[model samples]
Target: MADLAHGKPGAGAALSGGHGAASRRDFLTIAGNAIAAVGAACVAWPFIDSMNPSADVLAAGAPVDIDLSHVQPGQQIVVLWRSRPIFIVNRTPDLLKTLQDTKDISLLSDPDSDVLQQPGYAKNWNRSIQPQYLVLVGICTHLGCIPSFMPQANSVSPGWLGGYFCPCHGSRYDLSGRVYSGVPAPYNLPVPPYRFVSKTVIRIGENPPDGGDFSLDSIEQI
Candidate 1:
């Protein structure tokens, strides 16, 4: 496969980060409410470097560990990391195959993840460290709108293969988070710096074991 950042001939975009302490309490509350509005529970974050993630910690780009033991295939859970929605999808075998098919990926704008939208380890056909799990920033590349998870086949349109649908502007991304060609969204969904801590645990806001010096800020868009 061609390199998204190097082999691609065009210039790619740059990815788009603070906080305080009473001030710290207020920030956490706001962060908690932001998550609540999205229907996600604010669980205590256990980062590899820190036992507990305070509002100040998350605001400062600390990692967040999420338990995926209960997340079944085809189910996705949203977790807040660095105050942004991180989408974790437990992909089924069928979805994995779809992401690898040449015909399917040909319809995407950046099938090879050549735009540096993801970490070095996640620049694959699946756009993830593991083929069965997909981690991405829930915000759309265009206008930063949160894209709705549309996993069911044909749920958004006739013959839809299943993925995310940005209701805000009709931008569509395949299950692998690759944007469809000709869409208003200029690039694929930004994949955060993440690593699988265990079989059923993921640590977001951190680099993968083999991913050296890769940061989310290096992505083409966020």
Candidate 2:
């Protein structure tokens, strides 16, 4: 449908380096994202370039191969696909528990993923093929502002068990990208079709072997 959040990471995201060894990087140019003014405290970013098919990312919507060996647990990286930002988070074990916490479920608008915001394969509590890793089309469904990756408990506010927060309108999503109740974003963040090429490498824009041909448009919203 329409272009997704085409800008820098959302404002005020409290970031933490997964391995703390990643080299510092400058602002990356995403498909449709602008060099957003991410404020001061959110400046340290370490990114890597992935190998894409011969087809240009904007032209053929080619599959992108990301080497996640360097992504330490509790860290995340961003890539571009079809001009949209793809957020890949290497979830930590403790963060995984928050997704299943009853209290976490109680705060979600669709903890069951019943809204079709993700493909059938991802229609579950964890919302990904693997619970340890998460892939989301990093755009807020409300107004297309990229949600800041707030990965610490209560990072945004009290009892906030680490998730993406859209400062634009206060919409909050869990680690699994499930939308929270009473939020402006009616739908959860869209889960892109992806499959693990290896234990540490993921190919975005492609589905799991058994996922059939899942279309990005099939989701209810971005």
Candidate 3:
């Protein structure tokens, strides 16, 4: 004759079980929603960032101006374009002559510079319009490390006329940034597409108006 429905323990147990079930369902729903939101945020961030201009884009194809007046003779300056360092070395008259005379043409990998290391206008012995002003990309062809400009003729191994030295390995380049025969570098350091906007102002990334395989527009979009 016990009151089955009204028993205290039975009623309490039934209520507790129902509450626990509801709580678990709520937790699972909330957690799932949070996880989905996080995933969506991750996907959206990249798309948002891409809309803004990147450093490479801003600098890639833009003409970089440098003042030649401040650049001293026999010294060099490093500038950044599309995250790559470009070297502007003002060679002494003696250094220019030495680069032209001492290095044997037969020994070079690209003797006539047939490769596309430089713009069409820069395909010459010095690889620049003015012999004293040498503008070149600072990366080493061997492994892409920035080469230290060694102005002294003997800074590197003996019989080292003068040029840049890549400390990462023993790669050496002439003042024109042309690689030596036995070095690890497969080719010469690239002469970034550039033009002299004026006597003192030089642009690093853009090509001249005259047409070629590569153009200013290509670099500007970087």
Each candidate's clash count:
3, 2, 4
Q: For residue 146, what is the lDDT in candidate 1?
A: 95
Off by over 4 Å in 1: 1-60
lDDT of 2 by residue, 65-154 (tens): 999888889998989888899999999989999999997798889889888777778888788988888999999999999999999988
lDDT of 1 at 151: 83
- Supply the TM-score for candidate 1: 0.72
Question: Alpha carbon lDDT of residue 33, candidate 1?
Answer: 80
10 residues in a row with least lDDT, candidate 1: 13-22
CA deviation > 4 Å runs, candidate 2: 1-58
Tens digits of per-residue lDDT for model 3, 20-72: 34554456667888999999999999999999878778756476788888998
Alpha-carbon deviation at 176 in model 3, angstroms: 0.3
Worst 10 residues of 2 by lDDT: 23-32
- Predicted candidate 1 versus true structure: per-residue lDDT over 1-222, tens digit per residue: 222443455533221002322344455667888878665332423333366666776577778889988899899999887778999999999887777767767788888888988888888889898888899999999999999999888899887888989999999999989999988999999988888899888888788667887877677778
Clashes of 2: 2
